[model samples]
Target chain A: MKMVLAILISAILVDNFVLSKFLGICPFLGVSKKLDSAVGMSVAVTFVMLMASAATWPIYYYILVPDYTYLNTIVFILVIAALVQLVETVLKRFIPSLHKSLGVYLPLITTNCAVLGLAILNIDETYTFFQSVVNALGAGVGFLLAMVLFSGVRMRMESATETPKAYQGIPITLVAASIVAMGFMGFAGVADGIFG
Target chain B: MEKKGRLSLLFNGVIKENPVLVLLLGTCPTLAVSTMAVNGLGMGAAATFVLICSNVVIAMLKNVIPDKVRIPCYIVIIAGFVTMVQLIVKAYAPEVDQALGLFLPLIVVNCIILGRAEMFASKNSVLNSALDGLGMGLGFTLALLIMGSVREILGSGTWFGIPITAGRIDPMSIFLLAPGGFFVYGTIIAALNKLTKGRAIKRKSMGCDGCPSAAACGGAGTGQCPPDKEGQS
Candidate 1:
């Protein structure tokens, strides 16, 4: 239990997938303009990350660990692509309301490096099945935290009229992201301090 | 599509439509592996190889693939090449493979490969697609190299692992961190915006014009996410 908590806290705070690890940055910058969309996208990503880990962990250990590790990348991506499609279809059919909120983001998740990166990281770290799932949950939550926080920063940036022209559009958002990421860097030792 | 000469198509991605600096595709690896100059170059080469090979194969099969499922087809093709590259890197340059870590395999999802497959390879000749891939691959490499060099120099006081600033100035380790990645990338884009006088197609936060998957995702009825939403570069 303590080990799980350590992994969860470290993943969420110290090694945040977006803020620290630089994964899934596209959506981090794009969908984070609106708080509502940020929340929705994060929920969708968190769910997908969990499902992808659940599916890939077993496939990798049970089927590919001995001889086919090389195939993991291709297999994982194809599985994730198919999984996203299936999730979208099932959601739209049975849970229309949920689908309406997450449907747009589902297709986008297919190419999200965060999902694939997390899958690969889980394998690289050699975590147990439950640990992998916990790590995924932590990563998803961390991403959510980053998005929600950055959206607030972006919302504030929207009203600031003094921004220079060269720093407009994506450039300024990146700078804001830089500051937000700096804040995350301070959490680096806190995880170890608490759990070590 | 304008009937342009082959050389121009090859050179297009080098500067004008530079995938990273301009189109903003594949930003993930651009920032991740670019912590060091050598890693950036290695990553660039690997991605270039995959890009060229995938482009050639996809262009060859463009006609046979149904429009409805071409996106999946492109992904599968890209993923195959990424695995091949992953294995090769692990075998020959285990160090880079180590440095890149998960990013090496994560290359399968790099938007540059898939975007080119959908936007250029699907419509052009095999030769043109290959050239575009080479050009774009080079462009992506060049961008990564620049960022990596900048970060390495400022962050670690070295370039390609060789000592460049041993004593004159202290290296600010922050440049190698996540914040530094964003700051450097932003500054470069700002510099380019200044140089181009804002002519670059800077995709507004809400617009989907430059996104590679816009057609596949948005056109397929899940379009509510705004094409720009997937800009996960």
Candidate 2:
């Protein structure tokens, strides 16, 4: 239980996916233009991360690492693709509303580096099954947190009247991210406590 | 089918339509791993090799892949190439592989690869697709190198591994970090946007009417296209 909490907190705060580790910056920037899409993208990342961990953890331990380790990349990717498909079906069947909300994003999650990164990271870090799941959940939540925060900030940046001639649009967004990243720097202590 | 005109395809990835600056795909790598010029060049070369190879293979097998599973098929092909590169780099340039880290395998998910596959390779002939991949790969490398140079100098006081900042400057480490990546990419993109505008002005002076995709624009849904984009280059 303590380890579970450690992984969760470590992923969410200490080594935050977006702000600190820089896993999923594409969606954090692109889908974050709108608040709704930002939230939607977060949910999608969460789903993919959770399912990817659940699936890839076993594949790593039983199949890939022990037997065909050379095929880690290929196998992990194939597993992630299958898991995305499974999640799509489950969402479409169980949560139609969620399916609608995360329509295209459901599949797009397959391409989200965060998902594949987490899947491979599971093996790299060699987390226990439960730990990997908790870590994935926390990482997903962290990604959502960072994306929403960025979107909210960008919403403000867009509405502002003007700025320096140079620091407009993307330049400014990046500056804002720099500040956000600095803020996340404070959470580095979280990892110290967890790994300690 | 025959590939589009060679010059058009080649030039497209460089200026008129750079995958990173213009199309805005692969934002993760553009902003994450471009901290050092060497890392950027290594990653770019690796990505370029994979991009060209994957484009050719995918384009040739375009007809074989069913439309429904096209995304999966393209991903598998891409993942295969990425794995091959990963192994090679791991064996030889382990340092570069470490610098890239997860971003290497993350190539499977790099939108630039699949985006090009779905948009250009899936439709065009093998020759054009290979050329497109080569051009896009070079443009991507150029963007990375530019960003890498900016970050390395400002953030670390070094240029391409030669320590030029010995007691000469105090680097802003933030610019070398991930956030720094975004700021650099944004500024470079804004600059590129301005250059595109300059070209547009020249074309308008020459009386070419306007761009082909002017009606389409960048933010098609939001109706806020980036100032001027005459993809006529």
Top of the candidates by DockQ: 1
Tell me candidate 1's interface RMSD. 2.2
Task: Please write out the lDDT profile of model 1 over residues B12-65, one tens digit for every residue.
Answer: 998889888988878888888888999999999999999999999999999899
Docking class of 1: medium
TM-score of each: 0.96, 0.87
Query: Residue-wise lDDT of candidate 1 within A1-196, one digit each (tens)?
Result: 8889999999999999999999999889888988888998999999999999999999999999899998998889888988998998899999999987788788888888999999999999999999999999999999999999999999999999998888898889999999999999889888779878
Residue pairs with backbone atoms closer than 3 Å in model 1 (clashes): A26-B232, B27-B233, B28-B233
**Per-model tally of clashing residue pairs:** 3, 0
Q: Give the lDDT of residue B10 in candidate 2.
A: 85
lDDT of 1 at B34: 87
Model 2 C-alpha lDDT per residue in residues B8-121, reported as the tens digit of each score: 788788767776766666677777888999899998998999999999999999899887667677778988999899999999999998899888888887767777887789
